[model samples]
Target: MSDNVYIAVHGGAGFHERKYEKEIKHALQRACNVALSNLGSKHSSALTMVEDAISSLEDDEHLNAGYGSNLTLDGTVECDAAIMSGKSGCFGSVGAVAGVKNPIRLARAVLDHSSIPSPIGRIPPLTLVSEGARQFALSQPSSAHLVSRESLVSPQAEERWRVWKCRFASSDPSSLSGNLNDIQDTVGAVAWHESDGMAAGVSSGGLLLKYPGRIGEAAVFGAGCWAQEASDVEQGMEMACSISGTGEYIIRAMLARRLGEAFEKGAGNSDGDDPHEVLHGVLNDQFWNMRRGRGEPDPSVGVLLLTRENDGRARLWCAFTTPTMAIAYVSSKNPKAKAIILRRPQNITLGDDKPCIYITGISL
Candidate 1:
């Protein structure tokens, strides 16, 4: 209800060794700047802003989305993407899609194409996977081909594929699917525009050498992203969230929707628990540990929450269970964007050199 546009993005939530921090930081900053620049202009809506932001990440080989996407065990590239519009609850997604450059744009195109009425009382499918998804993209009314399959395979990704294929051949096949220690997870964005409402989008190459046809949380509606407009902040509808981490844990735990519900319930509680506490408790104590009994290392979860307050203000909250999560954000009220390579969330404070990325500024 406020005339403010907010944008936030995450490169991933995973093991980022010290060696890759500088490049990761630059990627986060670049993505944030692109999103903010679009959000600042009157022409851009939240949907387009997020689409553009994720596209930028896809282009950057440092992060996983399009170009840097992980390869499958069979040495092929398949990607998944989804986009949602909070106003209508209308969404579209493509999974295990190969060829198209920006899968996020294809996801948006699906959403847009579905909104048009068909004379024969038919509605387009909300989600498409595998070869079917690729056919759909090719069928769209466009003169030039939107993407080529070979173009999707970047040199970096191809090299990763060659090396991972050798590793897959020698390693135990049973232990390969869930391990993401080597390759980073998904990338995503959640945003709000005063004129265009709220939107969220997520994209991923999926875990490296994962089983073919495996669909992660990013392709699922409630697990990967969600948004709602709140006329009254006290009543709890003013939140949007996007996530990047182990797809399995996020899907099993229902991270995005559950986080939104937590924010809603926390709004009416008299207890003074902060947003960070609520987020960390849900992510670490509930979700991360949920699968620990299976004798596997606790998978990390990274999240971004965008809330519009009662007093015409917007706030962004980011949290992750990994050693570091790459994130960046900017709001209409604060034009100077800040990028954080998050390390320890529990010990973060306002004055620390590596302070938390949480920000609340007066909205336009």
Candidate 2:
């Protein structure tokens, strides 16, 4: 392996309570460690590291993915997940699926299946949903195995669902906000390897009391995750990004893919290559402003991005419009991963039409 291997993960972008801070940070750190643990294997690549890291996040009850995901209106755990490869431009997704142990694994399976030549002249599916997704899981390896739907629901999630469901039945407009403290939107990972270039993946349980068959940004192409290698690598950057936030707004914005395009076109400031400026511009013009213009006062979203410059320097960038976003990063040179819960300044004022976004860069 060439020394460019690295992975970063996010524990969602929303209101994270201080009480669960330790658990959330530990979960993100564990995911980074999990991704790096298999680096010694000869076949490890960015795709596998992204998968393993997200699988670790999915297993953590502190996250809103495979296990402990938000419950649907019917009190069932339905999930959305997707994975993409920058080198090959291969993409796969599963939407509103239940009974799967690791939704990201199933999404990876979908991606792998797309590579197989069809017996006939038929097109393969880029996404699978509901029962079709579960059926597809059955055909994959044991890693994508299915379990009881109830087994995926944690006690805490169930209690949250019970309370939320009661509030929903009351039809109280004030209760629409639910419990922001317990809201964890999505979990995702972005990775880069010398051999495979870059890859990104995302998984989510979706919003509390969401419709039974609702699919979130995690299951949509170019919305939840995007990874791409520049055509002119000698003068360009390879990038991968995973997003978490309000699924509807995110899906409409196509935030991940748009960011990749912005990086490619150098659409930042007058210098035209500042990643930080690009992030702020996109969040302001494309996301926050659009939502506010539509009469939505608040728009929540977070992006975890990995970029490798032509000179082989890798950096991690995180930008969010929410109260907090949890992230962790580790590289082969720095095997010890660092996890941080990035919180916007409490005193940061939100103007009537101005964007309230925070952007940070970390050297890898």
Candidate 3:
């Protein structure tokens, strides 16, 4: 009812349970708000909002990105990120670039335009490749690779973090799935708005293992991120190139393309079957009903809903994995309810009688 578009975002679904102070929660939430508000104010472009949100989050050391990122099982930090724009049918991305504070912003820089400037071949981005080789060539203990090699010199204190030992079972066959550490710790964001179309971005600290090539869906075209004008496909919609990972890519694709279509239909009805309600309906019900073939369940997924309707209105909503799964053991677990926020947004409040279409009804 506030006419604010919808957007949703998340770091990772599979997280560890850790308690932080209210101030910490407020700090991160405020950070989220700042990113959203800044992008929303500047251009109102969905692409801009998602990309900048990622940039802001990546800048924060508390998050599992950029600086302070968890060392891969190989004792190094390798990052991946991507962004897609719906209206233009174009996107940009980057994979495994270290020393760069915010990998998502870099990916955003690539997505905002065309012809991502080719690197001079095998620079910092190739660190992952180099590290993985060292891990294997050295035959380093898998357990040693799982935790950071940083040495703490507090004479009276012990280490603060812990890594599992059995995590290195040779019998456990899943070669490429070597990233037992980072596979679950992830960050994903998508946004849609009025005056524009839809767009999304995903950034992750990849899983660790020997020979861990930079395989971020963010860098792969049309996998993790994608966009296209809902108003016209003939005009061609923009899409983010995503890497191969059936579950992750498909989920966002439907949210961007299909959800966009559903929102358009629901918004046209005078009864106020708004975008959120329509999206919720399709995801909670129809989408699953239509799911086909056998595929690994993508339980570690999150949403950022920010988009506008044909009537020139906007809204924001969010959903994520169950708390058991949403806990970012290595990162942060500050979230609302199971899928709803525990505290109401200070600046954002749903209008009365305008109902959420699911909880309440629309007005004339």
Candidate 4:
């Protein structure tokens, strides 16, 4: 296999200016760099690349995943995460798992250990929750036990939790408003490795002040993440997808799998239509429009796509419904990299002039 690799990441999907723009951009760039830098190493695969990528964002206090995850209504933090490999059709996820410093890492461990033998009569569960997941992690021969819940909570997170808890007691509905800009702040990554395999992973602290046991779209397979390995690359299509945004809406829309199916349908067309237009149309015309028409809260959505064509070049696409989507990308063909907070673009048609979903991407 060649050493070619590519990666992209988002801090979250909603209104997030908790830190200055420079700081946020730096975080995105740093995360992308961590993933892209491993492209040169022979040992790096798409699975490991994405795991490393999300770990960077999780460690940063500005993002809302591992160390800086949001608190539940009861002022406790419970995180959710999942990882899937396209080639093996294997997956692992953890939901409402607490006290772990990096949930994605635990998800990866589940994927790695799911098939291993336990004590004679025991069978390791593929997906784990709450205390079970934490205890499982400690039992494994991993480097360290799960971190204390206090060690994972940031000061900002603590303050936000306190305020929200007070509003909850007073029955103040005003504090429940979703910050559209920062709502898409959950992090994810999709990658295509030189070995001709695809993989994707997502991690998020559920919505602000959500119910204690809430498990968002991120922990659900084919909802927040999906990937399928190709048996014959020349004659068939291979796809991987990841979504960030309002978990409820994402679950309702079946965002990731639906998008992947559309790509598959595009491949069956003789004319070879680009999947980008199809993705944009679905989001603008079907998903976002329907939500707004129904008077539902339009939590912003961000999508990352990695697809492989028979020609051997990898196509990358990213789109978001928010005013701006923070992103960074790097590929072997282009070693130089940069991160940008891309603004949503509007298009004017003959009969209508409304904003269309903007997809900024590259083919490498």
Listed per candidate, the RMSD to the true structure in angstroms reads 5.2, 1.9, 11.4, 3.4
lDDT of 3 by residue, 1-364 (tens): 1224444455543333345333223434543454455543546666666666666555554445554454544455666667777666666556655445556666554444353344665322211222342232234231111223232111111111113223444444453332343333355555555556666777665543323345544455544555554353222122221121223444444544455555445443532255445545645443333332234233233344444444434344443332322211100122231122222223545443221212111111
Residue-level lDDT of model 1, residues 1-364, one tens digit each, is 1336778888877766688788877777777678776554556788888888888888788777887788777766788888888777778888888877888888887887888899999978888888787778777762113576667667877787776676677876564453445476588888888776788889998888888899988887678887766534555447778888788878888888787677666775642125666676676555755666555565667787776666656667777666677778876667566676766645554442222333322232
lDDT of each: 0.73, 0.89, 0.43, 0.76
- lDDT string for model 4 (255-298, tens) is 88777667666665643246577678667765786677777755
* C-alpha-based local distance difference test score of model 1: 0.73
Query: What's the number of clashes in each of the models?
Result: 0, 0, 55, 16
Give per-residue lDDT, candidate 4, residue 206.
Answer: 80
Task: Write model 2 residue lDDT over 290-362, tens digit each, in one string.
Answer: 9998999888899998888777889899999888899999998988889999998989876677888989999
Q: Best candidate, TM-score-wise?
A: 2
Clashing pairs in 1: none
TM-score of 2: 0.96
Worst 10 residues of 3 by lDDT: 152-161
Over 4 Å off in model 2, which ranges?
A: 1-3, 174-182, 267-272
